[model samples]
Target chain A: MKTQPLVIAGRTFASRLFTGTGKFSSSALMEEALLASGSELVTVALKRVNVADADDDILRHLGHPQFSLLPNTSGVRTAKEAVFAAQLAREALETNWLKLEIHPDPKYLLPDPVETLRAAEELVKLGFVVLPYVHADPVLCKRLEEAGVAAVMPLGAPIGSNKGLLTREFLEIIIGQSRVPVVVDAGLGAPRTPPPPSKWAPTRCW
Target chain B: MSFRPIFESHPWDDVKASIYAKTGADVERALAAPRRTLDDFRALISPAAAPYLEQMAQLSQQRTRQRFGHTVQLYVPLYLSNECQNICTYCGFSLDNKIARRTLSSVEMLAEAAVLKGWGYEHVLLVTGEANQTVGVDYLEKALRTLRPHFAHLSMEVQPLDQEDYERLIPEGLNTVLVYQETYHQDDYKKHHPKGKKSNFHYRLDTPDRLGRAGIHKMGLGVLIGLEDWRTDCFYAALHLDYLERTYWQTKYSLSFPRLRPAEGMLQPKVEMSDRELVQLICAYRLLSDEVELSLSTRENPTFRDHVVQLGITSLSAGSKTNPGGYAVAPESLEQFEISDERSPAAIAAMLRRQGLEPVWKDWDATLTALAR
Candidate 1:
């Protein structure tokens, strides 16, 4: 079955199965897993990688031509910190695409809606492709889209929680009315659990 | 609001009475409740819950595996100093003990770090007694700077400081801070900590608030078991945890249960916590909150530690020395407490592997603090 390709920030993605580089026991294992997933777009936490070294353990494994590194501001707590981290990530990874995540709360890693919106607007003005991680709030998703986010990565549940699709109703609402891409991020857990199909297009997950 | 107000509202005697008054019905209700509350926690830890230990253990093991998987994080404690101004009744490092006190120098600190690094320990907890003039913020900052490059995660178990002090240390790559309220009993707290800065019970009670305000990445809180009534003390600890989680929504939290062990010139435990009771407490904590991290140290015997690992423990420290420079620099230095589980890290890791649990050496990275500047 040939699925429709998803386009975000003017870049074409052949695979909608985006992956993340975290919690793997080793970089080699992470590389193998990401490769097996056949994900073209992989998100790497800027806080987890050594950006100064080109051959950093985690970075060295992510050099495949098919992989587009989406450096995320995972540790930043405020809008200013997110902007600073994004700039550093851009210079180090040499890509303007970012997963804007300003989560001050570490327990659940829930995104700060205020900080995400503020950072998204500033990041977009700075000529970066901002994909903000946020809650499954329909109004907040619309607000992020209005603020010029390339896509809104609304969480299915708390990050890393294996409980699947706790926020299905809100996700459906966001997917129904979203103008930009709606990538369901976090809490999808299993590989076989597919993202909900949208009426207009297929929803993405990372 | 700080936890001070909440702590003040819940009188110790009343809470203890309520926990003791819980009936079997309350315990059953708490066990059956889908979402356990603090009240449910009372029933779960009460004497009535003793009969349901097996069921509680099963649920706890399932919940722990569901959340943390079949993995246990490994860490070792590097005792940096035993110098103290406080006269803690249960500690060998108490000022009045008259033992030879030692504080690890920068050279000595790295030597200890080298030994732990050789053991494949990426997480190290630096322990010290409360002595302001010698082992203050300046000394701690230098220690972090010296040891940060060697370890992936660094935690401190030292004297409580103001919020500003934690703010300074966090930028220096300090990941977690463990400040245990020895006991929540006010008069007994004063009795145990008779002298020095630690005698300030309210100040110590509010230390977590300072850490949270300082934007610490993680903070650990617990009450020393066998201090007063273990049940009441732990209830207060849980209440404090609940308040901190709501207030410091940004910071991560961990809980520890340190049963008093034999130490030189130390007083006997006021209340003894049986191994079975401790197991009940661990399982009750898991049922209460699945998100919080639970840790057990080397104070327990190997058999107890091994058995409880399956119950609810998320992290464990093996091959720990509770004295200054006991690792490599000054092995002859006086230890603050006697450790029971003296198994090497490799041996412990092997044991974990045998039990179908993976031993995780490095779960955090130093690069997380790269943007602190």
Candidate 2:
């Protein structure tokens, strides 16, 4: 069985498991893990990079010719902050692709549905390929798709709990109903299962 | 005028046991159900579901792939100030710690913004202590104005402000506010926050209500894991989020699991939430609301964060600075808490790519916050 590529914002990804850079022990370890996983698109929290003098440590290690940087507004909890973070990422990472996240709550760090919807509409209008991090509410997913989001990212669980699919039903509904791509972000666990559906298997934000 | 339901309160231990007593059959039933209800959530979070982690992950991944299609959202935190009045025992900025405190000046805030901008970050989370005079509403407003031009989105993590203050700041480009209840246990809450206005648990509990009333677009919620029973505290947090969502129907909500990371002058965490338990809790929250943003900060170790990328996490914070001007202004100052994963942005991005996830930036705009106003 041949696998298809997962494409977002004009990029193609061969693997289905998308990972984050935040929870690793060291950069070298994270780099090795990413290489081991064989992902094409990687997410780098803009706050961690000193995008200024090309000498920033994080950016330097990501110098692999094959990978593209996806700077995210992970810490910004509102629409305004997301926009500002996106602009910074664009200037530093030199990419127009952005992952919109606005969660006003600090403890749980959940996204603001209203702000995300509002931001999606605005970011798409701003010429950036907007991918929004949102809850598994199917209605909101549709709204985001309508607002022109490149994709909708719903959490499988909290950011690092490794608790798989707490919102399975709604995610199923979203997967069935969504017009854009469905990437399951956050709350993933060990790859203990027989690998995911190959290629166009659909709905995963690793 | 005391109107209340008389349903007997179940022992928290009982509820937790119930949460764990689920069977594989129950898990299958929960998984097979066409439309999930709260009962299904219970089964999914139960121990019986442990054997089905792969199945659950596959479903979660499948759903996520359909909606998000292989992408990951990235972000960073800018510590605005470390001058805390609240005595959070676990924090370096706890009032009683007597550490050297620092709050960013307008200039310092700008310098930090410049650094983040150069870092290719379009989002920013502004952080500070509960000190009002140095990092109060007025100071926040000024800092927002200074930063508005540099970044696309801005959020704050500081003292809880009045609805009017949030209203004012929203217009100035302040977008989100992260307020974590140190713990839900009212008594323990007092013990942890012995001094300062933060001790007023009721007031803090009612903060999201105030934020909702103020008509802010999004708000974040969570509990500090070490101070109380993670289960009960999390249940209450979920209850709070549920209530707030109904009340603030138009607003968006997210949750975080802040396991106690040892700080400069705090006691050891009382209740240790094991990795398995953390996974259960995250799954519980995910089962509760797929829409709610689940965030993992640099506080967590990298291996865990890496493992979870495909499970169920929506947003992540990397290379975070938890001190005032920690980015460029004053690198040596005190931090509210030490960040665990200190990798640079590029290194993190490379890791994400290897996982087959695309990093996203510039997802929102200041214009949207103004629209809410």
Candidate number of the best DockQ:
1
Report the Cα lDDT for residue A154, model 2. 89
* Candidate maximizing lDDT: 1
Two-chain DockQ for model 2 = 0.05
Candidate 1 — which residues are off by over 4 angstroms?
A10-14, A20-71, A84-97, A122-129, A146-148, A160-163, A189-206, B353-358, B365-367, B370-373
Candidate 2 stretches greater than 4 Å from native: A1-206, B1-26, B46-48
lDDT for A162 in candidate 2 is: 59
Candidate 2, residue B276: lDDT: 69
Q: What is the lDDT of residue B214 in candidate 2?
A: 82
B96-184 per-residue lDDT for model 2 (tens digits): 88677777778888888888877778788888778887888888888888888777678887888887888888889877888987676
TM-score between candidate 2 and the true structure? 0.65
